[model samples]
Target chain A: MKVKQISVFLENKSGRLATVTRVLGDNGINIRALSIADTADFGILRLIVNDPDKAWQILKNNEFTVSETEIIAVQVPDKPGGLASILETLEKSKINIEYMYAFVGKSGENAVVVFRVEEIDRAITFLQENGIRLLTGKEVYTF
Target chain B: MWNREMETIPRPQLEKIQAERLRKTVERVYNNVPFYRRKLDAANIKPEDIQTVKDLERLPFTTKQDLRDNYPFGLFAVPREEVVRVHASSGTTGKMTVVGYTRNDIGTWSEVMARTLGCGNVTEKDIIQVAYGYGLFTGGLGAHYGAERVGAMVVPISGGNTKRQLQVMVDFNVTALACTPSYALYFTETAAEEGIDIRSLPLRVGFFGAEPWSHNMRKEIEEKMNIKAIDIYGLSEIIGPGVSSECLEQDGLHVWEDHFMVEIIDPNTGQVVPYGEKGELVFTCISKEALPLIRYRTRDISILYPDVCRCGRTHKRMNRVMGRTDDMLIIRGVNVFPSQIESVLLEIGETEPHYQLIVDREGNLDDLEIWVEVSEKIFSDEIKKMEELENKIKKEILSILGISARIKLVEPKTIARSEGKAKRVIDRRDVYTK
Candidate 1:
């Protein structure tokens, strides 16, 4: 499923992130979700965008390094044990979660959760084979 | 260590092998490369007369300009179809000069480079991270092929993106790196700024080349990176990064005499000086197939040592090059020459010949301040002429050379009076090092 996640190379410098974001704005690419994985010398900025290929193209053209990947986006009713149930299913399947993000749907009811799993295809297959509902690109993006 | 083909050859046998190769290379260049033949013809020397290594001096000297005039592949000894690879000097900033290699030439290059890396205790077990730029620039591919030939896992992380370079080093467990000394130093400094203790890194040795550096600066690098900083020397005009290298002894860089011949000659008298005497370094590529250069003037000032090393290798060694004899400067490890800046000014058509190259080492790096003469042609007396001239020269010089230069508009005749070969370079790095 399509996920709105941002991946950026994290340079520890404060303004370096700004340079990447400024580039997105200048090129008119909007960031839907963003997080950073960091080491001392660099950090990977993970991002899901409105235009994945164009966002990547804009960054690469400006000499900004970018890596693209697919992930699983699951929608759940905003109730108790919502995150716990998804976690138990992924945990049982032995799928490692590198990073994940959660947000409320614009309609203000269903919960949208994005996960950058270690094994993407297998993660989706396990969820599909287990009767867990997954969000499509249009559903995740529009919500 | 397994490929002991040329390195393990006995000294006397190596000499004989070189002599045979030298004579053939002389004859081959005379027959195939018209440029070398014309140069030999003008000097009244026949290729047949040069039978021994001693007779090599009798041939005329080849120079950088010769490479430029015979631009691209004119100097190649073989047909274009036989050539497997081409590497060029960024003579892109000057008149471009190119060099080519056959399959055999590339093998010899890799062997010599492996030997250079071997000097630093590198082996097949080490992962080599190549940070030098690839493509036409020889620094990247030169190091890349050699590391691969030596059986090391290589990271072809060509220059730029400091963050990615650091991440790759950590993520891949890269143990060695190759780049311009300047950039490597910059990487170390950037790492520190980010709270990265350099001692925590995996890099153990760095092969820095394509620029001039000092022993004192070498100490600084060794301290900063907590790794051995090995100096590797090469120019695209003369093979690539395998030309010569300094072993752990750090006494002098050992030149691969089996493939190339080395001589130091007095520039004024054009006479070969005895061993240990300082003079311009020259080379004759005895084993090069695509371009067998003969007595090519490197314009680098250095001396050679013929003694066998404690490391048990018998290859000849060259003292670390002091500096270039031409319009070259080592400001903070950057090769700054007047021609590079002059080209930019020429493109704009408002600069004059009167320019002083001012170089100094700051806090931890070298800085260049170009004191250029402001010609009235581009500036109207109505403006603050000096300020406008300063901005113009600064912008153009920075654009040409990625390094910034402090442009000071000195009034005509303000750059101290020089009588002889104009003292264009006033280096202040030496004082700071002391």
Candidate 2:
């Protein structure tokens, strides 16, 4: 139920984000989802790629500061209350959400929401016990 | 003038005094300082061979490294008991370039400073505010004693505390301000930010030194502060910030010929250059008691104006220092060397020695930013890890350079590599200073 996410440190200079994308694209690594945490001086480009290990090796070889982190992807109903219902359940269980981003599934009627939480195992257990469908690493990587 | 008899002494009389004092200083150092004696002996020159100031060329030139080799008190001529004071500057290596002062040396420093303040028209009635840092740096006490020597009421404010500096400048009716040129401009900006019009203050004269500044900067300070800014020159290896100063003429700094024997030498060849020609400014301290430097190479680039000044002072004047022959950067009046930064980076063993220093001036203040290449291990992609490394590097730089910097962790191989001498410092302040 855990997916691997890679984050790259970037100085807040023009063309840096473009460079990161080009590096990943040149290596045939497709980014499935991404987010950026930024400040006036610098930014962190977090990416979920189809091949995280290969992407990590390529970026590291290119002298990019890259690290791997474990994140969870939960499939929620494509309806309006999908994300809100899962958030309400997690909030009830007192599992804090550090950060989250979502993408619509390619063929399924459900949407995949990636989440970073305080406790990985506890969050996975709570979501599974609550009848929430969790996407595995391979499923999320291809989807 | 503070001392009319000496300040305006005729050229013939000045040379006679310089020659006489030069002989005595060489003898004192050759007898008292083992380092000087060994250097002279290695060069096959005896103290008796140096009969006049012109004979100083025969002596070995002392470098800042020599001072560090004799760390703490190795180069001091007088015994520890007679040494009354000590001042030091951070060396490129871990050691410090230290200088000691006897009671009489301190008195001589005060006397030269008195003449410095006098050049700024600071008299007994003037309320002088000394903002140069005190302590181990020669700037603070050097200016302080000079103000006291002339019977001026001194506001020993040292440095920093911008709000208090402005308040006291107004409340005490400060007439003369003594500090580094950068600090003076920084004060102006801070005062403007505080909505305090510093130009309207009672300040009339400014003595700026301890760093190389340009004529344009002088004009800016004078215009902004509504005061006359005089340039004062000195180094810790020499006697702090009172080695020389500008008179009302503002043409060049008048080296106290009675105390110091000035020489302009070609930095590349170590040969003496003609008067009025640009070269490295060198000095031989004739009056210092504890530390008698012999033909000490200052590494500061400038020319000596032996011609008479319009102010009628016959002491030889040196043109404002244009730049340095070495890779020393003066940021906020503190000397920073790239080697110093490289050593710190190497010692930390976190980042590669590949780094670039970007120095620019913002708001009339010098801003330094160092770009260090992040190795794969240190750049864990975690913001917290990178931030901790950045903080560690910043702290080390601050502790060593005595000036804060903005540290940017760059991707490896981002900094350009030069084919020859690696380009380390990219100083952008020269345009503004010029």
Candidate 3:
């Protein structure tokens, strides 16, 4: 299932991220998986939340600018070569991954790997055609 | 039926006057003002090229920075001995804009002042109370000289001493007043408090300028003082306040196009705006002998109206100035000027127009904040009344200005009052170089 991730734009003013996090926490929007890309002056907090649409609305109402993107969620066994195997499959499909991160499954039986890819729709189609099971957002985030 | 300029002759006649003036002025500049002659040589434009009125564009536009860079005396077209009257703008950054007027130039000034006074319906019997400051500021002398030229008895009450200002108005039976719009309101309020019979006072009209004011503000002043508030627009570089004045109809200030050529142009591109669009105002003073400025870029933003004015004077009128291009504060991609804020405050009724534009650097970007003094009687006796009034004012200011101004209702006169032109901006957004 495709889930939209909201990337909250934040500047690194001492407690800016904490203020945003506190604001989100106060609004009761649960963060599912989060990754931060930061520079000296500012940072982008990309979050997969329990209700991204609601969280985005809340942030926007507070005058925070939020943008969305689709990320690949792959299910891997709790074994060493699982990530390597997925990368090899993507290479075989000639799909180059831009950047990636791993989210340990909530129940720890497996890991949900997320990737920023050059072609997200084609990667999803190629994986489905190759019988590679993509993790359901519910299974990866709430299992 | 009311389409001709009573003062203006035919086009060829006007061109002949301009060419003769331009030739004499160019010769004067080439001989006396080395900087201007140098600039002309650099541009490969000789003094002979400026023989026609159409060649005005060939000359370069002078800027505020040019005045600052030259510091002083670098732009005088005539010798120092020939300069009879001198004035300068109160430059906050460096030096000051030094302007000179020869005896003939002063005559032109007085003549223009007479024309401006003609707009106000002043007769030789009228008592002119010139309340604007008399220093280097062009307001007082502009009105004073005009009153003198019109053969009216002059009371040169050069600004301040509001108590005496009222006293003379009542004592001398002053028929007309001239000052900045804000200070005029201050006088009205003071006159009201003292229970001085305003109706008994002979203030039939007021010539308000040096800062932008709105129709609502003018109406308020008119209603309070029982006088019509006519706008007289000018700057130090362009021979001051007599440059334009609103006729009795209050249509717009009619520019005295005979001695001066007025053009509105793109502030950045210097491209001339068509007759009806708003742009930066540029003035070419063709007649002044001491320092005739060729296309001096007055940073004030305005639009030219070539429409036939109801007044018999066919001189092209400029819409009451909206704001200054230089005074504009670009905040978060929004262009906000203090004049716009003042108009917003005035339109809403019962809001004091004391405002300071405060801009600061927040994080890596610029943050804008505005501090406005609350009107004397905001409904703030109860808690709910205070909050409600604040919200109302905030919403109104926001609706007109586009950017949300953090409205702070400081006590009256809390803004360091300037007897002359009020300082509108306090920008502190220096780029942090780390």
TM-score of chain B, per candidate? Answer: 0.90, 0.97, 0.75
lDDT of 2 by residue, B392-429 (tens): 88998888878899998876667887784447989988
What does candidate 1's lDDT look like per residue over B319-390, in tens digits?
A: 777766786775543446777877766775654656778886565556888765544344322123335556
lDDT of every model, 2 decimals: 0.77, 0.88, 0.74
* Ranked candidates (DockQ, high to low): 2, 3, 1
Rate residue B103 of model 3 by lDDT: 94
**DockQ for each of the predicted structures, in order?**
0.01, 0.37, 0.01
lDDT of 2 at B5: 90
Candidate 1 residue spans exceeding 4 A from truth: A1-143, B330-335, B362-366, B381-406, B420-422, B431-434
Q: Give TM-scores for every candidate, taking all chains together and pairing residue i with residue i.
A: 0.69, 0.86, 0.58
Q: Which portions of model 2 show Cα errors greater than 4 Å?
A: A1-6, A33-35, A60-63, A67-143, B190-202, B413-417, B420-422, B431-433
Q: Where is model 2 chain B poorest over a 10-residue stretch in terms of lDDT?
A: B376-385
Name the Cα RMSD for model 2.
Answer: 3.9
Candidate 3 per-residue lDDT, tens place, B226-284, comes to 88889988777879888988889898788877788888899988988798898988888
Worst 10 residues of 1 chain B by lDDT: B377-386
Q: Give the higher-TM-score candidate: 1 or 2.
A: 2
Task: Point out the higher-scoring one by lDDT: 2 or 3.
Answer: 2
Predicted model with the maximum lDDT: 2
